[model samples]
Target: MIRAVPVLLTWVLAAGPAEMTPLVTEAVIQAPPEELWRVLTTAEGVLKLGVGAADIDFRPGGLLRTAYDPKVPLDSEAAIHTEIVAYDPGRVLVTRIHRPPKGFPFMNAYARVWTVFTLTPEGKGATRLRVAMVGYGPDEESQKMKAFFEKGNAWVLRELQAHYPGGR
Candidate 1:
């Protein structure tokens, strides 16, 4: 006679080491630096890149809000809010996500996180775009958030690459 025993299966996923470090991703966009900068700074350009509808105030100490639903108001529950920390025309743009949507995972944990886009002319009619996400703390939540942004940013860059004219 044999007795059946119940078996339980569990899986746990982690974002690896808790060290505070910046996650950097880069891509060579087949567009001029000025055009790439416009894509990074303008609402229409962002919409073309498929991130969602954007309401961008492209300046230092300005607001950048994005919502998937165009009908939603900028301050509505569906929006993601970030502050423009700094910008150098056709060179760099820095933004910090100070207010993520309510109930978002690790929302409170991202108070210090920043996303920076740097562009440089890579020769005739091409630009090198580098994105760096910084200010992740040494904690599970921060690590998880960092990993999430790393993937998300990579997708954005890929989208930019695909959307730009002459990009392959």
Candidate 2:
């Protein structure tokens, strides 16, 4: 039997009570919401983004976990613990990262972070894809950590684009 691993959900308090600093990006996909949603909710689908393991339940209060390859050169593992904070089939998918993977320094030092994706209809055959991430960090170093993710998210979507023809 294929044992299911818990997926990472979104974390709303990573930095404390400070205003949520969000990194937002949007894309217009030729595919329908159903197609996009399918890819986003699948394990293989999310792996294409160059991250670690991804398993999300797609339902509220469900388990969500994402882990990166230890072989990667990045200082932090690609793993992120989260749960299905919210979901709207064919519309929005949101996950909050609660647990950071092992060997990741400073995993327990900050508030939590949450990621949200919204799909809007843009006509007869187009979909507007909006991805946003909000998390907390206590000190400047932590803030910088969040900043790193702010920038990395762009590349994350770019990787996603590669899966989409003409993304490069």
Candidate 3:
């Protein structure tokens, strides 16, 4: 009765932006965390994701880069820009993407994105690996990216699992 309609609209407006649906995935590997950590911190391992040409320093704030041509397939790229945001030996590795050359025209149009990987030791010579990534863009566009990361992480887990001493 006393401007109740206005009050309801104000409450809805104050709810703020919707929570982002984070892209996450996990895998259990027969390899030790140390072995997995090495691959996670190196350039050769980075190539598997089709991210970019990598020059990884493997330390906190260390340089991580990948380069690729915008016109060609991403895997053929010669360079891509990335930075090491966090590096916890044998446990976690996180990086902020600077400029992604391969994912252009669709995935990496807006703000920067970050990827984090956590490795937990499991009983009897096994490890639990988790990957979490966040990306920014309009909801419609971001959804496509979310799906990409989901599939990519799945492929990564499969590849890593195969690399284990005794295949699963």
Candidate 4:
């Protein structure tokens, strides 16, 4: 039987009362940080992990554009847009989702969401990856968005783990 490991979830409130809560998920991938870094930073690697075709420019303020549905033409207005907020090669990367796909349910309903990926090298060839989705407002729509991404981010991490079975 394949036992499933529960994904860890946490919440952090911003300093002020008006601040929104941040949703965090963490996982330990059985692969080197470098390999996972490539998956997160490169278009080809991201495509291999099933994030759809991507046009990634891996630098601060660069774009990581993706089309989630292959049925939708790449040039169509269905691509989701994210910008790199900060990055440190194989260690850390921060990105903000600035634009949702056209006609998305929550399009333009909430503030931009910041996703921070921190990779820490674990024992010989393992990496602990922590993904934080922040900047959610204290509104119903924002809470819905947070819940949506909490599951989505966890699935992305699982896909990354599957990409490196038994650390290859």
Candidate 5:
């Protein structure tokens, strides 16, 4: 009986944390890391990347507020607001959704997700850019969000790659 107790305790101790897999996308941008970092952290850069309008506070704990409609003012409730977390000048930028616009999907899951953007210098000044959406729980809503970003993030990465040489 004592041997069985030890075996059961060992099994329980051997169990690991819950599976947490991020949706990751990587591509080589034709620009250097410095240039790409600017594109990621500035309001003009956001607009150039096909976002309509942006008001960016480019600091840790600051906000990146954006609206998809050019005429929609940024202070309006229609804007999507994300918070800037820790960032390295030209290497990484981490952020999480602060306030999503109305009607945003997967409301139950969005609160827990964070995005990490990493830029690495590759051959000939090209930058290897990686985008990772992390912190997804194993719920149905999270699964749905996972499916949405699988297509959405890949498209954005492709666009960002094609958008190099100039941020347009």
Candidate 6:
């Protein structure tokens, strides 16, 4: 059971004003949108997350598969597979978990969540990256899942920002 890996998802810009606020994280990177796009849509780029191996099908309905254990094959149950929901070149990318790894906690709440990444050009070869996680239900479990993502997603964006340090 994969009880310790970060979860992923995308969709629902806002559940509703009456609902819980979505978990949104943002960072400014020292790279162009195209540069970031390359990393976002490629296997090597995702490995920056410290995964062992990954394969990306970068299109709507495509799959982004990853395994934290380098020795594990992508097709194995320990890998995580996310479905690309929608994307615009160097602009926005959204995804939802197509199939979670074994032993993943929060299956019920996990299925209802999604994640979206937005890229905006900041002056001087920099891009502002914003990630939003949405679609949480109003329940204790949902709240827990949401909290988990708030930290996980923020950490991911930080890692990405680090990837393009000092206007690289």
TM-score for candidate 1, residues paired by index? 0.82
Q: What's the lDDT of the predicted structure labeled candidate 5?
A: 0.79
Model 5, poorest ten-residue lDDT window?
A: 10-19
On residues 1-168, what C-alpha lDDT tens digit does candidate 6 reach at each position?
Answer: 242122221134333221346688888888888888887899988887557799998877899999989888898898999999777778989887889899888777777777888999998898888888877888887888888888887777776766666622
> lDDT for each of the candidates?
0.75, 0.65, 0.65, 0.73, 0.79, 0.78
Cand. 2 TM to true fold: 0.72
Model 6 ranges off by over 4 Å? 1-20
Which ten-residue region of model 3 has the weakest summed lDDT? Answer: 68-77
Q: On residues 1-168, what C-alpha lDDT tens digit does candidate 5 reach at each position?
A: 456558534533443221357789887888888888988999987775567889899987899999889888777778889989768789989887888888888787887777889999997879988988877778788888888988887777777776766432
List candidate 1 segments past 4 Å from native.
Answer: 1-20, 166-168
TM-scores, all models, native as reference: 0.82, 0.72, 0.69, 0.81, 0.83, 0.83
Better of 4 and 5 by TM-score: 5
Give the best candidate by lDDT. 5
The 10 consecutive residues of candidate 6 with the worst lDDT sum are: 1-10
- Report lDDT (Cα) of residue 33, candidate 5: 87
Tens-digit lDDT track of model 2 for 84-108:
7767787888776566666555564
- Cα error, residue 70 of model 1, in Å, equals 3.1
Residue 45 local lDDT, model 6: 84
Clashes per candidate (backbone, < 3 Å):
0, 27, 9, 0, 0, 7
